[model samples]
Target: MRITGHHPLWRIAAAVLGGYAFTWGFIALGMAGAFALGMSFHDAEHLTAIIGFLIYLVLFLWAFAARSLARVWAVTAGGALVMAGAASLIQHQLT
Candidate 1:
């Protein structure tokens, strides 16, 4: 679980790629939730996009700093799946 002994490539991939997936899911869920709450589409998207950038930065840094690569991957990947699924459900409801 220690990040140091494992290949740095894994850490970098977790940081960049996993962070992107998590951030994308966050944006999608945030936008959908906000829109469901009656926010304008453009406003919801803009707000969520801004928040997603900050979330991605945090996730990217955490990927390197965390002691467990498995935990990092699980959180990012699992969160993405759950959030994206919620977003899809919200979108279906909206439609």
Candidate 2:
């Protein structure tokens, strides 16, 4: 999975997109988990921000380190979707 056959800019773009996906996805998932645990809104937000950075760094590394740009997107998008769905479900349950 050599990163090839495209402009370097495209590769950089993919990495940037992947980084954003992972960063937000992790934060959303963290907040979702906190909500599922019945945490207050303020506490959930603070906790998500506190833990999200470290998680983002690891996920950002994972995104750029992928052998294929497409794989980076697939994993990031899939993870985000799953987390979003879970968050929605948890919120629904609470309401």
RMSD of each: 1.7, 2.4
Report the poorest 10 consecutive residues by lDDT, candidate 2: 1-10
Q: How would you encode candidate 1's per-residue C-alpha lDDT over 1-95 as one tens digit per residue? A: 33355569998999999999999999999999999999999999999999999999999999989988888999999999999999999999999
Runs in model 1 deviating more than 4 A are: 1-6
Best by TM-score: 1
lDDT of prediction 1:
0.94
Enumerate residue pairs that collide in model 1: none
Write model 2 residue lDDT over 1-95, tens digit each, in one string: 54456745655665566556666776776777787788887898888887777766666676566667677677767777777777777667777
RMSD of 1: 1.7
Q: For candidate 1, which ten residues in a row score worst on lDDT?
A: 1-10
* Global fold similarity of model 2 (TM-score): 0.74
Using Cα atoms with residue i matched to residue i, what is each candidate's TM-score against the true structure?
0.94, 0.74
